[model samples]
Structure formats: C-alpha cells, structure tokens
Target chain A: MKIMPCPLNGPRNISEFVHGGEVRDMPNPTTCTDREWAEYVFYSDNQAGIVTEWWLHAASGYWFIAERHTVTDEIIRTYDPSEIFNQRVEFSDETTAKEVGA
Target chain B: MSATSPESLSKRSFVYRQLAGASFRDIAGGAMATGVAEGNNNRSQAEQSALLDLSVLPRTGFRGLTAAAHLQAAGLPIPARPNQASVTGSGELVLRLSQKEFWLLGALSDSGAGVDALNQRGLPAADCYSLYCQDSHAWLALTGAHLPATLAKVCGVDLREASFPLGSIAQTSVARVNVVIVHHQLAGVPCFSILCDSAAAEYLWESLLDAMGEFGGEVIGSNALL
Candidate 1:
C-alpha cells in the first residue's frame, strides 16, 4: 500500500488522505476583478514538475501542505499549515470600503 | 436482582440495538452493558479478546489556537506533542490529537466525572471551542492479547505494542472508515479505545467482531473491563 506522511499523524496509508487541490495565493476579493477571483477559486496551474498542494487526513480532519512531484507521483515533503499561516486572515467589510472611499 | 434496561434510558448507545442479550446498568446518563448472561465467562473472554461499547460514555474535546492554554489553565495535564496522551490523576485520559486540539475521556471508575466537569464549565475563551464528541462520535474498546493481530486484519497501521506503545494515538482508517485509536489500559488490562463517526458505529462494531471471530474474540460488557 502507498504511504503518505502526515504532519500531525506521521506516516499512514494513502487511502486515508484526500487531495484538496493546489496551493495558490489568494487575490484580495475586494480589489481583484471577478474574473481573477473566479480563476483563483476554480483553476490550478497543473504544473509538470514539483508542486505544493493541500491534503486532508480524513480521520483527524487535519489539513496540511504537501510538496509532490507530479510526473513521478512522489511525495517529497509534508508540513503543517501553521508554517505558512502564522496569523489569521480577515476580510474587510463593504462599509469599511465605502468609508475609505469617502 | 434485576438490572436497568437500555430502552428505559433517555440516552442510549449508538449500537444499543445490537446489545439485545446483554445485561444493562445505568452509567454516565445512559445504559451500559454489564454482561451477556449471568454466570457467563465474560471476564475471561475480555482477558483473551473482546469488544466493549462505550458510545454513551462521557467524552469532550476542545480545539482552536488557544485550546492548549485553556485546558492547561483548567489544571489538566497536556501532552507535550500531538498524537500523544496523558492519563490524569483522576484516571481520565487526555488525548492531544493535534497542537490545538485535546480530547478528555472520562474514566470508567468515576463514570466520567472528569470530562463532565470540564463540559459543564464551558469554553471561556473565544479562541477555544467545545467539541461535542459525546454526540458526534461513537466510542468502543477492544481488549486482550490478540488486539494487535485482530486489528491488523482491517487496519494498515502498525499497532503492535513495541511500535505503538502505551499512550500513543493513531488517527487512521479501519475497515475503510475513519477512526481515532488510542493505546490505553482499563482496570490494568491493556486495550485500544476507538472513536469513530456516530453513524458508522454499528457497521464498525460488526466489522470488528467479524475480524475477531477467528481468534475467539467476542462481545464483552463493561463489567469485564472494570
């Protein structure tokens, strides 16, 4: 059986994990065009070489980032999301935007 | 003497329907199986290989960025790292599923007083929130000598005592269903405590029993464990 190393639970059977799409930078919803937002939410680069992607360990409900080689289907490394997200992200309200515009 | 019936309890086990022949007694606000038949070899069966339902027992969890600090402030001992567990002085099992998530399991001897106390206290910090494991997960205990071998039939993890060790936790799939397994002991008898989705309780219980049939494992009551 293929094994995937989980940042929180150590090595486990690959069947216990679910692919959660690629890791991509988010375009500020308030400033980016609708098209840009759509692309961010719906598209992936699908690169041929090594890529960072999201994975979920179904049992623990833990989500982490994994760098894997697309062509060889080899998992290079896995790490906790905390390494990338140190602080919480907050979205500004429409009223705040209007106040700024005023 | 007569024992309480599960049908009479306000709270019942997720697999209560499957416990038709077992004797029941009040515990943790629900009916727990005490024996299958009077004068039967339930204790012996448990010492060899047996499965016990603990779905109605008290269990609670907390998670978020500040959960660890919150639990520590409440005077509970926290594991130093994720996927580890610590037994409390009062016999409660504290499991650190992740850096920010901890689950408290009430000790059978106290009928879950430790967990219930924490649940009653409520979450005081906004960064930490309560996890309703009592309602969302079904708990089961597998005991005795053949636990590792029986689990090997359906689980891919290496649960042998040498590798898994006491207090080690594994969040993995068993029989293709998600489950959290903790290597723990009950009344000095080593056992594995399994927590799984409430909806899959019956299915997993039957699956485990089927896997254990070859080793003479059978359903046991909480009396055997205590």
Candidate 2:
C-alpha cells in the first residue's frame, strides 16, 4: 500500500474513524421551518448494523463514507457517508456483486 | 492455519497453571523478555508500527485467579483480577471474567519488570502453579492494505486515529479467546497485530484467512514473513 499524506487529503489511515449512524429519514428543509429540518438533518439512527450502516471514516483525515455488510464483511459500498445517507438508494435487480465492480 | 508448536511446558516464576505459548512468552520471560531485542526497529518505537507486544497491570477487582504456584511468584505482572485478552484492529478490547462477562481495556507493552516484583507467597507450595513460556518459533505479523476495514468484521472497536489514535493497545477477544491487539503502521498503511495463545493459532488463522480471501490475500509461513 503506497502511503501518501496531502494536507487537503488524498487518503488517511482507516483507524482514525468512528461509525456514526445510518443516514435516513430527513424531513425536507423547504417543507418546514429551520428548527424541524435542522434536527432531522443532523441526527441519524445507529442500528448496530449487524448487516450495514453509515460508518464515519473519521480517521480518514478526510470526510468519506464506508458502506459495508456486517456479516459477510464484503464492503457493499464506500461513499461519502455523510452525504450518502442523503442520496437515494438505487434499489435495482442487477444481482450478483460481480455484475458491477463499483 | 499452520501446525501449532507442541505446547512447551517448563518451570518458571509466575504462579498459575498457565500455558505460555509464543504469544505469552514476552510476559512469562520465556519469549517476552527478549521481545525488545528480537524485533526492535528503533525508528518506529513510538510511531506505532505493526504488531506490538502489550501488557496490562490489573487492579485486583473481580475474581482474579492464576494456576496457584505463580500466585505470588517473582517476576509476573501483579495479578490483575482478569482472565484473557483479545481483539484485532477493528473489534472491541475485552477481557473475560466468566463465560459472558468481559471488560474492555488497553495500555502499553508488557510489564515484565512489574510482574517480576511480585512478592513470593510463603505457603509450602503444594503442586505449584508454574509459568511455562513457549519457545516455539510462532511469531505474528499482520499484513493488509485495508486492515481497518478488514478489522471491522470481528469488532466494533473503533480503528480510526481520532477515536483510537496511535500507539493504542487493546485487550479483547477475537473468536472467543483472549488477545492483545495493537494498531500499527505498515508502510504508512494502518495494520494491526493481535496475539493470543498459540494453541488458538489455528482458529485465529482460519478467521483471518477467511477475512483476507475477499482481498485475494494469501497466508505465508515463517519463511515468507511480512
């Protein structure tokens, strides 16, 4: 593994991370006043994710997200966890992990 | 998993009918004493490189017990009321008290000096509890590119620098046995070395080997060391 450290962040060690929570269910901001949307946007549920959840690669020295399967441990996906929870889950039927090498 | 070194039995100072394999030798003075000498890369002493030897000084809480002879024997960590240690890089740092009870903790390297200072008990030692260190050539070095992600499979113990930081030592169970795990750098890549009884080597090996399979990782013996 080639180790590179850029002040702006190419990448950092995984050790400096904390699995924050599952990004889900935020009430749209425009639908409500500031307070209601503020609470929904900041907090998320942490379900122990024995299967999967949002992992804050806090130690990444950068802000990124890691989507991993808890049981098989094959990383289901890695994205910006913070923003990922906000992105839509593209539920598709293109089964088998080998299909798309994301 | 590879062949386990025949469990080596010998006379030593700590009072406890304990099996000292390559893993516990550092504290048992069998292998642990020479730990610093065997693999001391001066530059990374504090930088926290891969696979570190850690020791915990226990507080006599809970029900702490050793074999018997090693109870107060010279040169053993003052018996901390505890059972085994365990963990990898990503899991919890824990110690077993009974079948289910466990405590999470960590510290620096093994303190043989402190153990050596235990005042010998004065009871006419009945079948004395002996401290036997294993001399088998079973040493461990962890190798991985995604160790943090890999470690997440077994434990919820945070591996990030902010939560665990550098030079972190943890005592926990991986696959149910006691282990001492430390976070280290492998060519700047975060890696971890978790040590437990060599008898449990096969079990750990299988788990790690299984974990690495996803990454096309292969296991190499002593000759193919990292």
Candidate 3:
C-alpha cells in the first residue's frame, strides 16, 4: 500500500487522500490587474522537480501541504499550513507605550 | 408522502428481519461464510457483538475557533485533541472531530432537549457558528472481542487495543462509505460506535455483518447495548 503520512492522522493509504492543486501566492485582487488575476487562476507550473502542493485526507477532511518530487512521485515531507503561513500580530512601540499609560 | 427527514425515513435496519426484528435472536451460524475463503478464522473470532440502530437519537454538531469555550459554557468539558470523545455524567457524548469541529450525540440537556440548548448556551458566540441537527448519518454500536480483526477487513488503520485504545475516534472509510468510529466500552465490554451517511447505511451494515460472519457473529438488540 502506498502510504501518505498525514500530519494529524499518521500514515494512511494514498487512496484515502485527494490531491489539491499547486500552492501559489494570491495576488492582491484589488490592486492586481485583470490579466494577473486570470493568470493566477489559469496558469500552472507542472514542473518535473520538487514542488509544494496541498492534499486533503478524505476521511478527516484535514488539509496539509506536501513537498514531493514530481518525477519520482516521492513525498519529501508533509507539514501543516500554519508552519509557513502563520499570521503574526506585531504590537507597535506606540501601542505598547499607550497600553502602559506612557 | 412528503419528503421526511433522514432520521425518520428508515425506522429499522435493512437486515432487521434477518436478525429477527429488535429481538435477541441470532442469524444462522456462518450465514455469510460460504463465499469467503477458508482459513480466515485463525486470525480472530467475534462474539457477543450486536448491531443496534441508533438513528432515532437527537444529534447536533458545531465547530469554530470558539467551539470549545462554548461547550464549556454549557457545562461540558472540552476534549483536548482530535479523535478524543468525552461522555458526560448524563450520558451525552461530545466527540472532537478536528481542531475546530465537534459533534454532540444523544441528548444535550436533561429535558430531552433538541438543538435549542446547544444554541442557547453557545450564544453571543452563537453568531460565530451554527448548530446543525444532522440527520444525514446513521449510527450503530458493535461490541465484543476481535473488533480490530473485523474492522481490518474494511478500514486501513490499526484498531487493536494497543494501537487504538479507549477514548480514541477514527474518521475513515468502511466499505467505501465515510464514517466515524468511536472506541468506547459499554457495560464493561469493548464497543465501537460507528456513524455513517444515511445514504449508504444499509450497504455498510451488510458489509460489517459479512466481515463478522466468519467469526460467528450475531445481531442483538439495543437493550443489550444500553
């Protein structure tokens, strides 16, 4: 059985998973031109090398990113999206100073 | 008649008559053993296991970043992680399906309440999520020894006692039907509570019986389970 290691559910059959499309950054829709939006939706790299993509575990509905070699189809590693796309909240010096009643 | 909810659509299981209709009766021994290959009995045997229909129970589901806090407000403890189920003293089962999703099974309140209690307690935060009366799934409990062996025929995960001890849940496919299997002990007997989509309930039920036939399995009533 070809096993895909799920970050949460552990290794399971490949059949239990669904391949999400390639991971790409979303251009700011309000600022980008129409052509850029079209390209984002309609283009593909499909390169034959190590690439990052999204995968969903069918049973649990858990989604994670997998880095795999295109030619060998071997998964290099799998990780949760939060590892890379973590949304950080930085408190400015002004805000902190005001909170302390400066 | 007009379209009925999935819960009221099927009053009994497909094999209810075959199992003698809510009675403590057993199907013919080895009833499904003819087609399976021989020597399959050496691995395990199923006993005192019965399949009961629990579709009539009230079920409500909710999920969001604040779901745990909402449940705690309702006086139910928040399960720490995925696949963990906590049963309240009142016999309500809360299963944490994922980081943000949870399914509340059985009655949520002592008044035999439906979804109101869930919505009421989860308020203010209720705007953050919605409580759904999920009639889409069929529920059953399989209790006995060798549950792992029987489940192995359909699911790919290891369900043995050591690997999948008590209080763990598995959201996996069984007989090609998406289902949630919760490990629990009923009356001190090992039991696995399975919930699957109502559309494929009959097919999954039959498949489970076929898998257990080689081990001398029989179907009993809910009385034996509760």
Candidate 4:
C-alpha cells in the first residue's frame, strides 16, 4: 500500500485508513429546518471533487475537518476544530478594581 | 472542576490527572520485538498456586475464577472483515473495537500452555497479528474502590468508567513506562490492569504508591498488587 500524509495522526501508514465515502459540506444545523436538517444530518454528498468533510482519526483519537479531492485521498488542507475552540481564558481570581479605587 | 462533584468530573482523584499529557500505549497489533519478559518459568509449582494474588485483580483478571481465557481476533479491525465476533479461549482474550484493540485477560505464567493448545489445534502463531499477551509480558490489574484515583497520578488516560468503560483498553505510557490499560471494573469500581515495559516496573510502582497516598492506601508490592 502506498503511504500518504494525513492531516491528523502525523504520519500513519495508508493501510490504517479506510476510504469513508466522499466528504461533503454540512449545512448549519441551527438555521436549518425539516428536510434541510434531515439532509444535513442524515445524507452524504459522496461527490468526487474538491470537498470539505469530517474525518475520524481513529488511531489518534481525533476528529477534524479536511479539504480534499475526492478522487485522490490527497488532502488539500486540514483544520482542528478543538484548536479553534481553544481560546485562551483569563480568569479573574482575586482583584476588584472598584474596591482598590475606593 | 465543579465544586460539588469535583471528584466525578475533574478526572483527578489522584492518578487520573495525567489524562491530558499521557502518551497512550497502543496495545493493538503485535508487540515489538523487544518487550517485557520477566521470566519463562518459576520452578516451584507449589508457589505457582499462590503466585497470583487475586485481591487486586481487575474484572478481567478476576476472570481467573472462571475457566475462560481470551480468544484473539487478530487482523480483525479490517473494515471489511465481517461477522467477526468476540469470545474467549482458555488462555487469553483479544478483540478489536472501532480502530483500536485489546487483550481481554489471562494468566501471564500459564499463557504458553494455552498457546500450545491453540497451536495443537492447527492455528499457527503467524496466522494473524496474534500474541498470547499473557506470555507477551508481565501484567498487573490494580482494581479497587480507589483504583482510578490511585492511578491518575501516574497515568494520563481519563479513567472514568463512563468514558473509559470496562471494555476499554489502550496501550499508553504510565509513570513514563509504556503500558496497556486493560479496563476492568470490580463491583462497580473502575480499575485498570497495567501492562508495561518489564524494566520500567519500578518506576510504575513508585508512581502508583505516590498516587495512592490520599486514599489512605498503603504501598503494595507486585506480590500484593497481584
């Protein structure tokens, strides 16, 4: 089997990944209704072209979005959903500005 | 960490805190060429009877009371492989889940005899990515009311039974030693049987001791943890 780089899991051998149908776009769940919601949740585009999809990095225990060409598992780009949500939090442990001023 | 039920979700009863930084030891597939081998045999058969201490046994090793052992299902995680089921033999239990795999439970010492039986039945060792994991290395199942809390100090996995359930098993680093977390519970208490690199045992033991302090747990040697 030929080895290729996957966005996640660093450099795992190609054999480890199974071709999960065509990766496609997802509609916003909050705004969608009825068939649109059903389609968004239950259907797959399964097309053969540049597409953005969700891939399960089974070995590495990560799930992320990938932009790739359907015909070739050649991924165009990858982004970590967790990283996007990982904004730095600043906690206010102890210090009240009003009290200090007064 | 929630204030009221911090222990439930903080993942830090003690040893469970390492879940974030732990390098998971993947127990799937066959073991490396060089792995843990304590000794092939211990001469005293009489001692063999008492060699194992089941008090600390995980739900998996507690399996000793039962005649059942593991039946390996190697090369099975293959996507297209169908009808692959999980069961046990008299030696060891091996199974695959999602993209991961596990070694059910077995007696490390008596493993060869079990493998010999499988070989006698015409199944070759090379048939699948199979190893009598019991013979593959030294394993200790640290199960108790405070097991997950005790293990948190040295391990990195989230040992919550809700997340890492009884069937869950993974090969990951503990106390910096490579090990497989064999998920097993005892009387509703979550526990793990850790498999490690043989030479790394001392480090793991010390780590376990350091983590077990808060629970008023005393240090137990391998003989005790057995």
Candidate 5:
C-alpha cells in the first residue's frame, strides 16, 4: 500500500486521502480581468515536474498541501496552509477618525 | 452553536432488530440490550468483553479554526494533533478527526454550560466554526483479548498495545468502509470503538462477526460499554 505522510496525522495509507488539485494563488476577483479569472480557473501547467497541490485526508477531513514530482510520483513534503499563509486581514477595533465637535 | 435536531436522513442500524433482543429497552433513543451468546464460553473471556452497539449514542461534531477553542471552552481538551483523543472529566470522549474537525461522543460529561458561558462572554465573534449533532454514523465498541486478532483481519493499522497504544485514534478503513478507530479500554483490557456510516452498520457488523468467529465473537448488551 502506498503511504502518504500527513502533516498532522503522520504517515497513513494513500487511499485515505483525496487529491485536491494544484495549489495556486487565487487572483483577486475585484481587480483581475475576466480572461485572467477564466485562465486561473481552467488552465494548469500540466508539464511533468515538481508541483504543489492540495490534499485532503478523507477520514479526518483535514486539508493540507503537498509538493510532489509528477514524473516519479514522489511527494517531497506536506504542510498545513497556515504555515505559509499566516498573515490575515483583521478589521481594527478602534476608530481612526477623531470626533469633530464633541 | 445552536443545537440542531436529529436528521431524518440519518439511517438506523440494519442489525437493530437483532440488537433489540431480551432485556432490550428503549434508551438513547434506540433499542438497548446486553447478554452473552448461549454457545459462547463464559469462562474463556471476561465479562463486558464483547461487541457493543453504540449507534444511538449522542455525538456532536465541530470543525474550523476556532473549533478547538470552542470545545475547550465547552470543557473538552483539544488534542494537539489530528487523529488523537482526549477524555473529559465527566467521561465524555473527544476525538480529533483532523486538524480542525472533532467529534464529542458520550453524554455523561457536558460542556454545554461552557458553550453557554462562551456565548455569554461574547466569544467566537464571527462565523469561524460549525457544530452539529452527528446522527449519520453508527458506532460499535469491540473489547476482549481477541480484539486485536479480530481487528487484524480487516484493519491495516497495527493495533497492539505497544504500537497503537491507549487513547490513540486512527482514520482508516475497516471492512472496506472509511471509519474512525479509537483505542480505549474496558475493565482494564484493550478495547476499540469503531465509528462508520450508519448505513453500513449491518455489513460491518457481519464482517466483524465473520472475522471474530475464530475467537468466539458474540453480541453483548450496550450496557457493557455504556
């Protein structure tokens, strides 16, 4: 049986997971043109080489990313998304503008 | 999270009638019973070492970033890794299915009050998580000296005491169905609780029985585990 190393669950049978497709940066819908958005959704660099992709552990429902070689079917590494995307947008709790005439 | 009603779409165990034999009574919203099979050797195995149907046992499911915090606030200790389990002071079992998903099984201990307290304190400010009753799965508890041997027939993971260990859980397949296997103990002996889709209960049950036939597998009452 093929084994896949899960970042959180350790190594497990490959069958316990689902391929989540290539991991790519999402184009900002507000600024990107229709053509760019369409390409982002439909196009992929299918050449045989190392690629980063999403993978989901079916039983645990944990989703993460794995870098693998297409030609060798070798997984180089697996990691959680939070490790790479740590910065998040948060609304400021305090107001920026001062009261004009209290 | 608001308490959701049990889903009508949820399935009942196909072995329900078989499980509802003598001494069976209505509990946990399902038929309950306990007894040894007549042909089985009582001297061979300790009492309470048998298969228990916990399909009707109440379960709560939760997932997302704030879920662990939410459960911690509800009184269940969040396991540091996926496929790990923790027990509440009141005997409730909390199993982390994945990085952000968990299931709260058994009802003796409750963090409902803690959830209420969290809500009162205005925690979980956004829609950062989700929680609901898990009525879609069937559960069975397997215990006895022969448990590992029986499980070995179907489960691919090593389940011996030294390897699987107590309180550990695995997200693996058993009898061709994806399930969660938690290694627990009953009367100081190793026990495993198998959770799978309710619709496949009968098939899995029969498969387990087939595997256990070599070691005198028999259906015992829910009280054995409850």
Candidate 6:
C-alpha cells in the first residue's frame, strides 16, 4: 500500500489522495494573454527529478504541497500549502490587489 | 413500554430502513433506534463490540480562516491543534479537523441543545461559515474492546488504542468510503465515531457489519451508549 503523508492528517493510503496537477505560479488572469492562461491551465512540466506538486486528501478535503521523485515515485517530503501561499492571489479587471499574509 | 416509530417522525436516520426490529425513540425531533429485538443485553454487547447509528444525533461543523476564533469566542473549548478533540463541560465533543475546521457533536444526554444553541447564534464573523453536518453526514458509533481489530479489516489507519489514543481524530477512507473517525468514549465505553457522507451511510454500515461478523459484533442502539 502506497502511503501519502498529509500535512493536515498524518500519513494515509495513497488511495485516499488525489494527485492534483503540478504546482505553478498563476499568471494574473486579468492581465495574462488567453494563450498564457491556457498553457498554465492545460500544461504540466512533468519533470523527471524532484518536483513540487499539489495533493488533496480526499477524506478531509485538505490540499497540501508534496515534493516527490518522478522516477522512484518516492515522496520526498510533504508540507502545508501555507508554506508557499503566504498571500491570497486576487485577479480583478479593476484592480489586482493581492493580500499579503500578515 | 412502547417507543416512537420512525415513520411517525418528520426526521429519520439515513439508515433507518436498515434498523428493522430495533425499537425507536424520539431525539431532537428525529427518531433514534433505542434497542434491537434480539439484543437483550445491548449494554454488554456494546462493551464487547457493537455498531450504533447516531445519524439523527446533533452535530454541526464550521469552517473558514476565522472559524476557530469564532468558536472560541462562543465559549466553546476548541482543541489546541488540528486532529484533536476536547469534551465540553456539558459533554459535547468538539473536534478540530483542521486549522480552521471544527465539528461540534452534542452529548447524548443533551439531545441537541449544545449544537442548537451554537447554530442559533449564527455566523457573526465574515469567512466563518456553518457546515451542514447534520444533513450532509451520517454518524455511526463503533464501540467496545474489539474496535481496533474489527476496524483493521476495513481501515488502514493504526486505530489501536496505543496509536490512536483518545481524543485523536483521523479523516481517512474506510471500506473505500471517505470517513472521519474520532476516538472518544461514550458512557465510559471506548468508541470510534465514524462520520461519512449521508448518501453512503447504508453501504458503509453494511460493510462494517460484514467486517465485524467474525468478532460477534452486534447492532446496538443509542440508549446503550447513554
């Protein structure tokens, strides 16, 4: 049984988690070109070595970040999304005011 | 004495249809199974190994960036960290599922007063929103000495008393169904309160019973827990 360590709940069966796409910086939807937005939404680097990705613990509905080896499929480490998402990303046509974490 | 029939109640358990031969009682405007036809000693059976449906019991959840603060402001004792639980003076169990998500389960004796009071107070803060736990999930209590072993057949978590001690909570898959398992006690009997999607309640209940058949597990009622 493959195990996925959840930042919120402890390690659990891999079956309990859904592999969200690779984590990437979002291009401001209001400013970026439609092609840029499409690439961001529909493409993945699919790196071969260590890569950061999004994972969702289905039971708790908690999403977190995990670093794993693409070749070995070994989970290197797992941590809460707050580690990287310190600011709330806001996309607006009038103003793209992002709220930085206090 | 005759008990209330589930058909007469406006609110019924999600698995009420599977409770044939069990006597029912009124609880928080809903029908709760109080006893089974063959279980002459349900209390003892609960002490050994039994499954009790608590779907009609009062339970509410709150989630948001400020949900914990909101609950604490309401005078409820929130757990210091996620995946932990605290019992209130009135016997209500407060479970902190995440940094901002908390679930409040009313004590059996209180029916629904504790949760009702909190719900009535409303979400006075922005971002803090009330969750429809009562309508969205079905609660089941798996109690007794053989709980860990029986659960082992279906769950992957280390639910042994030593590993998953009292007050610990695990949100994981059980019998391939998503469930939140809270380790607590009811009337001094160790219990794992399993909460799952209401739509899958009957399926999960049946699966649990099938897994527990080897241990002489029996169906119990809420009265046994009280």
- Angstrom error of the Cα, residue A74, model 3: value is 1.3
- Candidate that scores best on DockQ: 1
lDDT of 1 by residue, B1-226 (tens): 5668888889999999988878888887799888866334357777788888988779999998889887887789999989999999888999999988999998988889888788767676488898999989999999888889999999999999899999999999999999999999888887999999999999999999999999888888888766
Error of 1 at B22 (Å): 1.5
Question: In terms of docking quality, how is candidate 5 classified?
Answer: acceptable
* lDDT, candidate 3, at A74: 98
Q: How do the residues B1-226 of candidate 4 rate in per-residue lDDT, one tens digit apiece?
A: 3212213332111222222222211111211111112321122221221111121111121111111222333321221211111324332434332232333443333422333444344333332234444433455446456656666676555667676555565544466565666564322334465665444554565566567656654422222221
Q: In model 6, which regions exceed 4 Å deviation?
A: A95-102, B1-3
Arranged by TM-score, best first: 1, 6, 5, 3, 4, 2
Off by over 4 Å in 2: A1-102, B1-139, B185-190, B222-226
Rank candidates, DockQ, best first: 1, 6, 3, 5, 4, 2
Off by over 4 Å in 3: A87-102, B1-47, B107-122, B131-133
As for candidate 3, its clashing pairs are: none
lDDT for position B23 in model 6: 85
RMSD of 4: 21.6
lDDT of 6 by residue, A62-85 (tens): 999999999999999999998999
Off by over 4 Å in 5: A87-102, B1-14, B18-22, B36-49, B107-130, B224-226
Per-residue C-alpha lDDT of model 5 across residues B88-143, encoded as one tens digit per residue: 66556788887668777764223133333333443376534545434577777787
What lDDT is reached at residue B179 by model 5?
A: 84
After TM-score superposition, the amount by which residue B135's alpha carbon in candidate 1 deviates from its true location, in angstroms, is 0.8
lDDT of every predicted structure (CA atoms): 0.89, 0.39, 0.69, 0.41, 0.69, 0.89
Cα deviation of B111 in candidate 6 (Å)? Answer: 0.8
lDDT of 6 by residue, B1-226 (tens): 5669888889889999889878888999898888877774468888988999888989999999989887888899989999999999888999999988999998888786899888888685588888999999999998888988999999999999898999999999999999999999998998999999999999999999998889888898887876
Interface RMSD, every prediction, one decimal place: 0.6, 13.4, 1.1, 9.0, 1.7, 0.5
Alpha-carbon DockQ of candidate 1: 0.87
Q: B1-226 in candidate 3: lDDT tens per residue?
A: 5322222333433333334312221111111111122222221222355454555555677777777777777888678988889887766678998888888876312322533466556354353475453557777667678689889988888989898988889888787777889997655667788988877777887888888777666555444433
